[model samples]
Target chain A: MTDATGSEAGTAWRRIADELEAAIGRGDYQEGATLPSSLALAERYGVHRHTVRQAFRHLADRGLVTVSRGRGTQVTAPRFPYRIGRRVSMRTNFGAAGISVAGSMLGAEIVAGEAEACAALRLEEGAPLWQVEALSLAGGIPVSTGVHLLPVARFPEFDRVFVESGSSITAAFKACGIPDYVRLSTRLSARIASEREALLLKIEPGAAVMVSKAVDALPDLTPIHLIDGIFAGERMEMVVEPFGELPSPPAGESGA
Target chain B: MTDATGSEAGTAWRRIADELEAAIGRGDYQEGATLPSSLALAERYGVHRHTVRQAFRHLADRGLVTVSRGRGTQVTAPRFPYRIGRRVSMRTNFGAAGISVAGSMLGAEIVAGEAEACAALRLEEGAPLWQVEALSLAGGIPVSTGVHLLPVARFPEFDRVFVESGSSITAAFKACGIPDYVRLSTRLSARIASEREALLLKIEPGAAVMVSKAVDALPDLTPIHLIDGIFAGERMEMVVEPFGELPSPPAGESGA
Candidate 1:
């Protein structure tokens, strides 16, 4: 679709890919829907078939479409929107969305806290900590791998409770007598997935993974645990909620 | 740098890299500091120099270090911590950190709001909107590029005001009589940088970039604007604040 002025040159393929992406975004192309054939797209755009093929390649590379031999290109399902808020829970969020979710402990160990984890949890370096590795699955597809660290002294039986409670961190916290907790801070970044991460998340090596380093705290803002999660970028998008009252505008700050 | 159980086979290089990363995290290597030489690291880890080189290569790939001949590997400076909260302002955030911040309008145009933008702003399909493209500089380095959209009819001179106010979105909002606004929601994802984005943000092509789609609303929760920003992943990290009182724990929900 051309804008008001017209399409820019040398970006014809990109423009086509963007148009197709927008179409998908608008729900014109639903999951499992087949995209138009290259010949048809070429005719519609008045471009060569190769150009349409290039556009298809672009879409496929973006994880928007999957092309198979003999079958036409099919639009991939959209990522689940997971909200990160004060009372957020992975299980509750996925369940409320009518998605079957499950979590399983991959491994667990007790080790001295690393410097970063120690600072976040307000513990001394080399303090004993429980490192729990877990995987979250949505509809039978692994979506994230999380490494959680907690002060071992505070939660002596954390690993046992986590595994026994069906890998629910909330359950483990409750077992440890922490009835409620809130997200204190979350830092967001991204990088190419490592081989191990890609294997756990079922994505190709070097694929983008959204990394979140988050801290959970008690009602009094006492830090409880630190979690670093590697989420399959194409499988989910993070929705963050900002909490608190809006601040009043500064005087004389408006443009006149 | 081996753990209690010892490093796994075939992952020694990764383990060493992780140890170095943690050391850096602990400030063993400050910004602008050069990491230990590969030969020294190799000897310390009881590994061959090639393994050390591989570790350095991995760190460089992650944008944590830059390796150049003769000068040794240098750690990249840490990015500014940008807080996304009730009153989120790029200029204000960097300014409070004692960093010189500036923004400039790269371009502006009136275009029909795309489906996603329209949905966020609650406008009719194809509604005319002013799209302001801006670049944010912190300490004279380009850190982010933002494309902000507002209903054209509501802010007729938004582009001019924004440009004249030194590219401050707050000033344009004030010009439109919106004294205050709050961040309603933000969605974050990541993707490989496009060539144009790489050039604009001064990052290498194919590098990871953090993408955020945010909605800002009035105090009463009426959506006013939408922004899609591409931030250099290696250059900045997003910090978010949670709003509202902590919810009481659900009865009988904790593990016994």
Candidate 2:
């Protein structure tokens, strides 16, 4: 409870922030949910809206909420502990977060391997490759859209098998006799999402999207898959535990 | 040289793409610079603009160029190989890229440590701390803007010392008797930049910016600094080598 009886304006905001923090801690305001408008809060507290804004700033500085222009203040959600280890599987990742991922298969075709994919797979130029497009969802929330390029020589009809496995890449790999694989390398960048990507992810066209280019390899370190992923930035935060469970590679070679 | 003589429209784009790739390899067109407009390229090659666009798409798929709607196709710049290791230093990173970083100090003040910084630094809430703001540029290209919170008890007058050291955090640490420090933990996300941040980084407002929250600790694992960095995402790429040079941490605790 805050003493609203003519307290100093500075301490007035402090008390408001304290009360809001307690409410948030009690789960009255859920994460990724907006709080009352400044005017509304001000009316309830009998203080100026500026005081309410000050309180919001305090909470934002404490990492409990975020304040953006045009968008009201919202409770900050705890970022998903996205692990970027050798084995990078979307299903495994969301499952670890206590959420089941529903994967949807998008465009699938047999096409000539592009130069980038060919180099990563160590195949000759114009090699026949299976190109598969897919999306992963957690609790019906789309997480990422990816394009997978696999050498047709290695897995003759991976696209069809992928759909047959309920869009589970792991199941498809297992069906193809790959019991285990490791992510060889991953490069991360962020940029404004294009119209097509935003439409697929159901986000604003100008929203941020994290672009990841990764290569997955077989147990023997043979490149098997080239993946390009576009992730809705606001929905995910990647945690890279570089040396968490794995030992360092040999000198002059890192994550090859 | 590509034969301008009539050929199948399909392979015509292929030959044009090959020639442009060779020109790029020869450094005729530098990274981050746009090529001739499609109309101009079409006139030169005696082909329709659609054929030139097809060529652009080929190069884009090959990871050599990026084609945006308004901005013409530009050779993709090699992203800075930003390494996230136990010891993270912007000066060291740009230096390795053969570019010297110029640091500019912004707002600096003594402030009460907010909950987030206090929790990271193991200080009491409202603990007195020195808040320093700075930005780093590489070859006059702004790389990142950061706000650092350091315990005033440990590094009294550190802000003044930082300014005295030519706005170099590394040099200021040395002056404060901290010969070396290691980055304890890092968390990364991306979002649209604020107007002030965009202006500071000289990027367009609403552009994507990678946000990093990190803690730097002394050699004995005592956190000394809490850093919040906003990076211009288009200019940088993060390379996280989890197990590149370091062995695994103790079980159950990683990157502590």
The whole-model lDDT of each prediction reads 0.77, 0.78
| Alpha-carbon TM-score of each model against the true structure | 0.79, 0.78
Give the Cα error of residue A197 in candidate 2, in Å: 0.8
lDDT (Cα, tens digit) per residue for candidate 2, span B1-256: 1123345897789788878887887778888889899999999999999999989876775456877779889998866768777788888888886898898788687777756567668888789988788898988988899888899999898878888987788789999999998877776777887766798899878788887877778877788988888888888987665435322122211101
Provide per-model DockQ scores.
0.26, 0.26
Q: List where candidate 2 sits over 4 angstroms from the true fold.
A: A1-28, A35-73, A243-256, B1-29, B35-74, B243-256
Please tell me which predicted candidate would have the highest DockQ against the true structure: 1
Task: Report the alpha-carbon TM-score of model 2 versus the true structure.
Answer: 0.78
Q: Interface RMSD of candidate 1? A: 10.7
Per candidate, native contacts kept equal 0.48, 0.40
Residue pairs in collision within model 1: A243-B243, A244-B243
Candidate 1's TM-score reads 0.79
